[model samples]
Target: MGALDYVLAGVAAVFLGPEMFSLFGLPVSLALAMVVLGFLTGILVGATPGLGGPMAMAISLPILISLFGYSADALLPVMGFLIGVMKGATVGGAVPAILFNTPGTADAFMTTLDGYPMTQRGQARKALKVAHVSSAAGDTFSDIVLIVCAPFLAIMIERFLDLPEKTALLLLSLSFIATVVGGSAGKGLIATGLGLLAAFVGTGEDFYPRLSFGTEALSQGFGPAAVFLGVLIVGELFRGIEDLWREKARSGQVTQYDLSGDQSLGWADLRRLAPHIGRSALIGTAIGALPGIGSSLAATLGYTVAKARHKPGAGDPKMGEGAPEGVAATEAANSAVSGANLIPVLSLGIPGNVAAVFLILAAESIGGFTPGPSVFRFTETAVNPELVIAFGLFTMMMLANLMNWTVGGVFMRSLGFLVRVPRQLLLPVVLLLTLTSIYVETPRFEVILFTLGFGVLGYLMRRVGMSPLPFVIAYILGGRLEETARQAFAATGADPFFLFNRPVALALMVLALLVIVWSVRPKGEAS
Candidate 1:
């Protein structure tokens, strides 16, 4: 099949797939229905203070797998839902930040600076409109880039890289992620090492398990669903519960707002905000294309740049003082990050952020869809199913963007009540839901125990200022890394220093070392 033929086949697979039910006498594809459902659910979770996109994705993944089962036919519907959650949550996060000065995640913090101020000035609706429009536009721009660039990048990777080179490239990616993801390079490395250690505990080439210690349970290692939910969702819930306990009185208080005046976003308003949106969209896409940088940094950079360039006139607000442009800049940048983060995932099989992690996890669990250069291969005689699935994913994202542009604003603006739901009540419910869902999937008590154990580890990591992102990514890639290294060694006729023999591989390893050394350098010397 040619590239164009693969693209069309993918579109047909999504639109003409198995029917979930009939809507208005027309058959509704299961993937299409799940996308819409996930989008709406994403908005609800994103608006809540203690819940965000990653947590929702982690909690829902187990349930999704249980319901759909492990079949090739289940991949599209499962992936479509996850993609919807990712896109919807990016836009929904701005709602609570604008109306209630509550940010569900780090990326939404910048939105609160100007968003809450706008609410105080009775421009809450206007701020939300600006956020929604800017978010939709930025996301659209990033998706187009991903659609155009992923296949080209993947093809280039397939053409230029051999096994040894690929192994070295993976090392470079891991090292770069470890150094850049957290406050201290040392702590990040520690987290990465621990993740790799945990991943190595189960099976290997030997007849016996590598690190099982003669325990029957450890022989199988940890389940991916349990590990992800424990570290990402359960761990956060534990921390939130503790924080809320300390500030019970303050957390319980609810403030009422009189939202009135200039609620409409007119053509003139969009014209004024266009420059900020465009600049931040570019900034965010560039940053998000790199592994481990994340949307929080993009939001911060976007807000800082827009603030520096902002010139307030008479009867106008300053950048952080109820300016609609402030909301637009932050929201646009963070939203843009969500789509561009998928570029590395599709091209190199490397996840760049928490949301991308789940997408990779879904593909791994579902099987029949390996996310790498091979996924984009076009063969003349045989049909490439992964290529069709890739196109199907792009179509799902476009569907999500369409929903965002049409009815998303109306739905987002009506979510002010979510801010009033205290974490004290919400955290326990989420914890219970997560545990119950995990039990339903595996129906084993030991799996729950493993999840709790990992949850404690995750909580401690958070308390010590270490980010879990590096750990999670390392865990996901550890087995693949080992397999590639083994292949590279065999391919080079059992050469001990095979990496140093190839110029590209040697250069990548040297670059990886330099990245770590540079990250640990003194601020004055580095500058």
Candidate 2:
């Protein structure tokens, strides 16, 4: 469809879709309001140290559900808000990494390697601006990919995939995610298996409680939002607090950035980063389309590849030493993965990451739409053209990107002001906001207790050098794995060899076993 056509369609969807908004006894446009609210919310969540995009989505889902009540009008705006947060968070993570040597998200860890050093060298503002621009460019390009490619892929998957083949495809996707993410094959398999186990902890569809430990609350499948926020957001809060205590003991001076210098990107910088941006974007998009893989993996792989291709002394001044290219490569790849991750969800009904899975849930709760190939079919009848939603989402992303680029530098500069504020003031604010958001979601004081408990668990896990990604992934995928296993068995009448009989399924099973073996092998051994 033409650009103008897409725009008009999106405008119509925003106005006509199902959402309840009333102002002064007149009907208000909820989709437009959601778009605006989502952007602001994203900025708030992204600017916070512990809260990331996935946690934001988890917290927002139920609120949107209660407010909008499962209308297409309601769903699109919420999705738009999520997209804003995802994009904003991707850039926002760099702020803490640059100023305090603390990575706000896993994807921003690489930023710390260079960013913190630059801060020590008194170039914090420049580094922060570079990060913002590069991240925005990468994210904007990825959204473009989502606009162009997702629909075509959806059509193809709808035409070809059978149940057994689809199952095999999922296995392949998971294995690939594990291998690419684990640092080594063995680590990856271990992480993936661990994640699967964590996912199995609460309850299954057969009304059977698997690992509830006899607790009534535990019997009702573990809330994904709780685990996600606990492990990521609350866990980081504890870490930040501990760091505060150390800084207090040492009487460390809080370093602040001077933003008086120009923060705008020049054409020369863009030209230098162009190739790396392209390469990382391609890598991220491909990785994101696969289930189980995520932006972290894409960022790491992109950085590694960029480092390997560097010419002698091309990294002179050091590659990990405040080089904008490093930030560009990592940010571009990770941001691109955000868009690509949606591909599998929108097209094939499979989630590519924890965030996408939550998005699927949100879509279901708000739109009464099951996320899969069939969504496109239903869009043609039950709602406006499917393409309209896609276009609207892309437009929202573009708006979010513009906001990130223009306001991100200002936001980072303002954070420098926070350095002057005492930790006593900052910590309480952070704690209060977190508690309030969590409480609003569940209304249970026990949830706060659980969050604190998980925070300790998360901190301990980090200290041991064990990757939490595996656990999180397993926790997210556990229910689906169990359901699929049950379905496969039912189809085979409990025949153990049924999986082996299907060529595609057998191939996937073999691949999964091989991945385990290969990952377990010595580091020097070839897969």
Q: Of the candidates shown, which would achieve the greatest lDDT relative to the real structure?
A: 1
Worst 10 residues of 1 by lDDT: 248-257
Summarize candidate 2's per-residue lDDT along 135-200 as a digit string, tens digits: 777777777787677777776766765555566656665676677554665565666676676567
lDDT of each: 0.89, 0.68
- C-alpha-based local distance difference test score of model 1: 0.89
Q: Model 1 reaches what TM-score against the true structure?
A: 0.98
Error of 1 at 403 (Å): 0.6
Residue 392, model 2, lDDT: 65
How far residue 460's Cα lies from its native spot in candidate 2, in Å, is: 4.1
Q: Which ten contiguous residues of candidate 2 have the minimum total lDDT?
A: 375-384
Superposed model 1: Cα runs more than 4 Å off? 524-527
Model 1: per-residue Cα lDDT over 60-151, one tens digit each: 88789988999988999999899889888888999989988889889999999999999999888899999999999989989988999999
